[model samples]
Target: MSKPIIATTSLAGCFGCHMAILDIDARILQLIDLVEFNKSPIDDIKTFTKECDIGIIEGGCCNSENIHVLKEFRKHCKILISLGECAIMGGLPALRNGIPVKECLEEAYLNGPTVGRNTERILPNDEELPMILDKVYPCHEIVKIDYYLPGCPPKADLIWAAVVALVTGDELNIPYELVKFD
Candidate 1:
């Protein structure tokens, strides 16, 4: 029998989640031997192919690229795991939900004291930048999320539990160390 294919992808996030996965260290080595890593930065992956056994997506939908990735992940992975607080509830970036997108962009780029202040030159309607969603939402809102493990970057043990469950087809006993945050 062939080993299950496991793929990991990132969206609008700091990539801290990806780094955290590596924090699993030696356990990941075991995982590498057990499953094929179809998509992950560590493997120089850039896209998702069809029919992945387990897909781990870290980050939230914040742009067109993110949306495209999410939809593709939904279409491809049999079991999708939302890896962190960002994918579960849009983290720090979602804090801007109450503010206008234009104002937020200004605070980031235009209105900064160090940046040039030229409203006439400022273009809020850039074609490349996706319009911000009216409110932050978890992955399930856009597409069905089979499982979720929440944390700023979820406790590594939780990630390991989820991976084991997916690979072994068993219910994971949520360890106290893993669910303490909830």
Candidate 2:
């Protein structure tokens, strides 16, 4: 039988979740034996070449490009798993939820301490730029997420367990120690 195909992407948050996948370490050899990857940053595939069995998403939607990629994942994958706190609840990026987008932009480009001397004070307005959303949104808020692994970056064992269970049709057995969000 052909191995299940998996795909993954990072949207708005740090790539910590992808790092956690690598943290699976030596067991990644086992993972390779169990499944094949498609349209993933791990393989540097920019677009889906075929349908995938599972799609693991690592971050939340913070801009138009993120939404587009997520919607494409939903269309191409049979099961979609939100792989970290960022994918499940918008994580640190959602801290801007309470602030107005204009204020955020001004602070980032025109007034904040990091801003360089901008005599013209130009905000990025190139049509090529992906339009930023007013607030970061969890994956579930935008797409029909089939499962979620919640943590700043979910434990490597937890990720392993979930992937194995889905691939083998076994019930997920997460250890108590792996349940901590931190």
Model 1 lDDT-worst window of ten: 173-182
Per-residue accuracy of model 1 over 92-180 as CA lDDT, tens digit each: 77887788777777787776777676767565676877766666566777999998888767777777877887898898898676763
Tell me the TM-score of each prediction against the true structure. Answer: 0.88, 0.98
Q: Write the per-residue lDDT of candidate 2 for residues 1-182, one digit (tens) a residue.
A: 99999999999879999999999999999999999999999999999998999999999999999999999999999999999988998989999998999999999999999899888989999999999999999999999999989888899889999999999999987878897665
Q: List the residue pairs that clash in candidate 2.
A: none
lDDT of 2: 0.94
What are the lDDT figures for the candidates, one per model?
A: 0.79, 0.94
Q: In model 1, which regions exceed 4 Å deviation?
A: 116-120, 124-131, 180-182
